[model samples]
Target chain A: MTKPLSTEVDALSARHPGVIDRPLTQRFLPFAVAFVLIAYVFGSLASFDVVRVLSGTRTDLVNLFFLDSYAYKVHAVRKLESPEFVLSLEGSRYAVYDERPAWLAVTGEETDIDLGSDGRVHIKGDTLEYYPKDEEVAYKIKFGPGLVPQLVEGVAPDWMRASDIQVDMRPSLFARIWITKSKIEIHRYFLGWENFWFDFDSPLNGKSFGEIASLAVSGERMDPAMANWQYIFFQFWNNQEWQHGEVYYALLQTVIMALVGTLVAGIIALPLAFAAAANINPVGVARFGIRRFFDFLRGIDTLIWSLIFIRAFGLGPLSGIFAIFFTDTGALGKLFSEAIENADRKQAEGIQATGASSIQKYRFGIFPQIMPVFISQLLYYMESNTRSATVIGALGAGGIGLKLLETMRTRQDWENTAYIIALIILVVIIMDNMSGWLRRKLIEGSN
Target chain B: MSAQVTLTQNPRLREIGDAYERLSRSRSLYTVLLIVVCAVIIIGGFMVADEANSGSFWGGLSSFFDYPADIITGTYAAGWGWFALVWSYLPFLVETINIAVLSTIIGFALGALLSFVASRNLVRNKLIVFCMRRVMDICRAFPELVIALVLVLSLGPTPLAAVIAVAFHTIGALAKLFSEVNENADMKPVDGLKSVGATWGQQMRFGVLPQVLPNFLSYGLLRLEINVRASAILGFVGAGGLGAELKKVVDWNYAADISAIIVLLVAAVIGIDYLSGWARRALIGKTGTI
Candidate 1:
């Protein structure tokens, strides 16, 4: 049997010579030409500087952003009139010092910043000094009354950088000191986001989990009226830096926008889908017109719709929801009509035989068959639209997306941006799982 | 014997009828409750949204057609000048399409790699599959605009940023789909290859890939359609594309220019949809009903 099959295959190959016999050039030449053409087009049209991007020219910027996202800066500024140093995170008033970190010390007229192994930056009166761990000589800078900072002549080392208005010295990678006419400053770089849960002014700012747990169990109220746990919760909820409450509300708004948009779109699309369905409508022109109208709506895209709606509704969740609703109605209409056309006709015929009106036939017979498909599609769209709502929100529609964009625009608060991103990911994952579960349940349940 | 049969039959039939009636009554009650809840939620949500909006829904309802009318009138006033305006913005449109195409290609490549590793049928290690799946999930979770905005900060407002952002999302989406396709694929050829001592790569390339490529291509084309729209939106947030140009025109309140650009975008999207729809049907052999 195998021998005969092999012989038959060979005979068939023999009959179709071109199909079986391919020259090496014939096989590979087209691919080569296509590759060359793609390369040519990319080079000319994109004008992408492949070498520049690959050669690590932009690594510094990338590194700066990456480091900035995780690590925060400790800024200690001492003004000429003020003896005490003002400590802050990212120079934000919200994160200003209630008390300095353990490594920082401010006494009478002197401030000492111990930057771990990177050594120390000390400011005494009008003079600033950076003491490197590896080196014996300290880089010294003295500020004068003439609004100029002068590095002490022979004490200035190779790491010390001086300018007319400021004297800057880097004792190490982790520590820096700047002496200017108006103020003396030291900056210490540390890893990890600081004050994410609670700001400096909060009583619960630097408590460990164990400490917080103990506080929750037995400690006195931080505020006179509230319990210890309540105080902590309030502090974190109203956190000036992170604003967890506002973020949560924005997230809720985003989800609500998606839900409202998807549900409304589904509702609107049902009738429109029936109108577009060939068997239901029967009229070719009307069906054609309705289908083209859907195509137009879908082709307009959500961004353009949002832009147009913003003109009417102005900036809010309504515009975003409407944008999502309008675009998704078209998509859902197209999907739903196809499902309608594919529905089992015998059920509808049975209903029609019972002397039922057309509406009754559709309601009792047609809807039951396609309901599962419609629901599953709607759930899927809800999940996807949650993401789209974020994008729409960025265009001033309203939601966490607007917040994310606003945070991004600040170009500071990268940690907050990171937080927002994490929240979005969390929400999206939850929605994804929820939708998948619902789809499985609904579709499978119908069967 | 007749009296006993009548006595049993009457109670049994009555009980069955009562149970059926009870079940249906409860079911209808639940349905009514569900409908009521849905109606309340929808009405409440609409009210809240209306309140949040700058203009009331009723107030804005009348003026809903005003912007479209303005755009139409402005285009008509241009009297073929709209064509010139669209032509001038063609380069920007091309940039948008380039963003979509490049991102889709990059996404397809990454998604292919990820899908193979993530596929439970393909990968030997459960941990690797789990890790790859989560990575894809995280990638998919991020909105392209969010990623683009972040990238713009580090890379400036360049097309590359949009490409990376869009491609990142595409990888996640396509990987999930591709892995689903892989799961449904026939495993006999893979088993045959394995019996012959074929390597994993060889089995995948020769056995599985042939089965899944057409589906993957179809899905990829669909993704390309989505990415084009996404890339256009990314431009609104400062990533270079037709969206950015549209935003600029909108800011200047050049109604004709806005309408012209919108028309061109619609045309491009519709054209791509038709072309890709045709290609998909051709590749997939028109398997679906209707």
Candidate 2:
């Protein structure tokens, strides 16, 4: 009484026809896609030469980026001919210290360093000695002929690396000492950003937080003709090393660029969207032309637009705003037209029955229906354009992004780059949260 | 009809009418205030930007077409050589597309895994879901150029930097979107698989993935379109692609070359957009414009 499974399926397929006899293409489509994807992946891997890049990358630069971002190095440089030691951040003369810092003790020809658990470093004349905490022996680097520092005593520790010209002794992850006959440089690393609150030129540079707070509030004035708090505020805002005021202004400019760009784009697109909408435009040729125009606008990359604008407008946020506006108008126009096309026509018909003019009907019926979409889309673009503006700004339009590029170009200002990056992330996150919240409120209100 | 007429004439009706009028007046007042505030902000913002700019808007408007005009003339003069210029840029265009495609694939794979952990209903651990979401948010907050610029310094103008930058962004973006799709997936199959003693991974693989795969593919395709644009822009920062070529030409002030490169970029972008759009519709089994 039981038929074989294949014969029984055949019998069923004979009855149902197309239901059981699926096309070969239908069954093989997924496999075909998978095959193409896998082949492309392999082909790209070979063509991109990913292995060479991975091997060729300067790994130390990557490591330095992480180390340099949050921490700063204070270098104590002593010329071979002079006993006078110069202490400065990153060996920059502009940031030199007028008074001795607490970490180093100089007593005549000898000096002592408190390197924490890595033990003490004793510098006497041309000899640098690193005394390990557990070992009785000390590693000594002697500055010999031609100012070349050579390891002269004891087994060299793993942390100390020597070359023909200099010896680099890294006591800890953050601390390093470089010695040559020409100069002896001690780089002490500290956590947290230096000169963030006040640069070295400020009178309040080495003051404690409580002291600074008191200076801000108390009757004692740091400068004449200004209140103590005002002077403190001015000092902090205009800190030469940080440029906080300019950065904040640039950030504001970037945000304003996004806001203006989106708002103007939306304002212009709402009308053009009508011209492209199927129900409203009706005329096939005109609608097609408008639609293709939108595509043309959208097709040209914002980078190209900003570059062109930069040429005409010189270098500034105006170019950035124009670029964002031009690109977003095309995008918003397309979306708005789609929303218009999908809008329910029954309300418009009702308005027509009330003897309303076409414009009045669009305003009373269609506009209200699409208001939520328009608002939400504008807000969304505003957030995204904030990001785009940053990029455009990096491409020469003036903003925080331009400042970021400037710092990055310095090669040694990695800390400043990190600071700008952190600020960018903070502002972007804030915009995202604000846009989401506003979108919810606006959508609910529209309904 | 008599009752309706009496109701309209009642004191209570008048009170209701008065309240309604007050509400409507306040509402209209708010609307007008909002419109005025928006107008002022836009205008004020524009003025501030204009002041900060090197060239005034009105001053620049007259010269706006000067650059374009020059580019057009140059391109016209190049004649058939323009085709060669565009053709020469194809390899860089291919490099740009490769970065987008590879990053998309890698990001999709990583994002699929992260999305599972990030999904609230799928993952029972509240801390994991919270942490993963924040991680994704942080990753997404970073612009690709920021990462690419940093990497270019270390990697020396290689496409690998752009790839990693775009991939990092794609992972975060796709994870967020994929988790949203996961949230909408039917829970019954997962429950059924669990009751049959399936492990979490197996359950997710058999139950949840099948439900959300089509949408995942659709979003992945859409992300590919975005990444193409992103990678091209990343190339401008010395990450090596079509943008690098564009930047080179721009820096040299090669008008015809710039025009040709722009043409190629536009064509590639629009072509990819169409291809991805078509693929997405096919994958999702939907016809109307998104």
Candidate 3:
């Protein structure tokens, strides 16, 4: 999109009606050629594989997807010294397993009974010991019997491995490994979508596929059917707890990289912009050299610069920042110099007639005219750089992209990948708003 | 009179002189930026120097620049490998081309419709234009990668999903441009068509569209080239393209392959660039500017 200039179609057309020159052939030949080539390519796809393009990708996906690539370390809880028993999982209460403590000497129902902290309740007929201390870590038990067999039968790639299971009320960044006698079975599904992997670990390996699968499946709803306008509102009307957190650290890294990079580059670019401008250097050769210098540096894409930086500095956030800074310097210099070139000559002339020096003329005349454009350009650069940082980070320069890459490629965490995307969108909105605000301020301030 | 003529006649001399004086005046700003640029160039120089120092890399690299020296002159058949390379790039190229072509077409098609809504002379509702523009703005604000990710989440990771995402952006950008073109178009034909009881669609069909079609085509061709580049980029988000292949090589640290891929990519870019230029020139005819 371009800023509209004052040239009117009315006046031009008024002078001539068929002014567009009716020669469609000369003007549309290339478009026709392009169209033909594109058509040919698509038409030929049925017969072609081109080394079966994206085959390795599919193989990689197959390898990484599902539970075959996963391992778990879990300890069975019932085998340990604890009284936490599984409950009816379908939001119900089943038969209670009770025991009387050995030292209690006596036990009774007080309606609201608090079995002493250090004591265990012993059942009259059963040998099971009910430790109230352990019972406080209550877990939902299931009445249903067949959860695992159903899942394994449902999908061949699907597997249910139950291991060390701690029943921590809260979840951590990664699914935690079990400790001591607590056992956990993870319901991990690997899907091709965003390299998706989800794990539902619990203290109980509830009876069948339905009981466990219900817990896992019921968490997040990603069905495409929900995207329809009629259904979209219904789906989000009650935002599930599964809608993961945004504004994580990786996003912050990307934002910081863009801001710090462009600003640093701007600070470094102001002088070069002046030198490159045709107005500044009287010697044509020197001016030409400065101009070419800016071009040569900027011609290299930002991502390539990032790759180079990574190689030079080794893998880290530092390399990413350096890449952004280096590329922005050259690019911003070119933009700033162009702004300078397009400044009003009259203002500079006015300064010249006053017997002002070179620096004085630029300070008084050039700066005032070009500052607004400079800020506008700066705003654009900052906006563009946010996305660039994500790309560079994917190359292992450390950012949200690194998180995204690892999860997708190795961990196969599609849901988390979705969460990462949401975070990126949020940042983009924030950046857009910030750019708009800054542009308005710079324009108003200059005015 | 003579001094005035000299000043006017030698605009170049006056421009440079004035520029020099201005530079001298803004010494601090210019000096600082100068130092930064010099440092950047130095760093870039260092990278080149470092590359040169790698004996094998330089040797291979130097050999690469030799024009057709190792062309398979004999009856040596590199058929399958060559086929593999072409195949590897084929779908990617197709996807990229598809993204470019479809995006431009959809953008151009919908842009015309938006321009109709946005024309002040044709439509007087400021609120509608504002809402429409804002919607377009939001669409354009998103990078294609972000769009691909979101679509992959909502719609699944199909090529159709990618096409939709990119097309969404193209619609936004093209709509805005289309509105501008419509706004600047002559109102005489539109007024006459309206006076004759022509509907809004008819007026647009005959009155305004003819005036802006050439410019629209030119912009669309330019957008096509951009889409090709963008399609390549969407590979980073699993949208599927040449970028995915390039990414694999980079991740594997296959430096030779990386270099070759980049060369291919840049060559593709240049090819697209020239093709777009030809298209633009064709659209513009002998005009000085599009």
DockQ of each: 0.53, 0.73, 0.08
Query: What are the runs in model 3 whose C-alpha is more than 4 Å off?
Result: A1-247, A282-292, A406-415, B1-108, B111-134, B147-165, B177-189, B210-229, B236-241, B267-290
The ten-residue window of minimal lDDT in model 1 chain A covers A48-57
| lDDT values for all models | 0.85, 0.87, 0.57
Residue-wise C-alpha lDDT for candidate 2, range B1-290, written one tens digit per residue: 98667767998987887799899999899889979988997999999899999988998899999999999999999999999988888899999999999999989989999999999999999999999999899878897878888888987888888989999988998999899999989999999999989999999998999999989989999899888888888889998889999999999989889998888888988999899988888887664334
Please give the range of 10 consecutive residues that has the lowest summed lDDT in model 1 chain B.
B281-290
lDDT tens digits by residue: candidate 3, A57-80: 354344323223232211112222
How many clashes (backbone N, Cα, C below 3 Å) per candidate? 0, 1, 43
Q: Mind giving the per-residue lDDT tens digits that candidate 1 earns over B177-282?
A: 9999999899999999999899999999989998998899899999999999999999999888899999898999888999989988999999998899899889
Model 1 clashing residue pairs (backbone): none
In model 1, which regions exceed 4 Å deviation? Answer: A1-26, A29-41, A48-64, A80-83, A92-101, A106-111, A122-129, A133-160, A170-174, A202-234, A351-357, B1-37
Give lDDT: candidate 2, residue A172: 73
Quality of candidate 2's docking, in CAPRI categories? medium
Please state the error at residue A27 of candidate 3 in Å: 12
Best by lDDT: 2
Please tell me which predicted candidate would have the highest DockQ against the true structure.
Answer: 2
Q: TM-score of chain B, per candidate?
A: 0.92, 0.93, 0.69
- Provide the RMSD of all predictions against the true structure, rounded to 1 decimal: 4.1, 3.2, 16.0
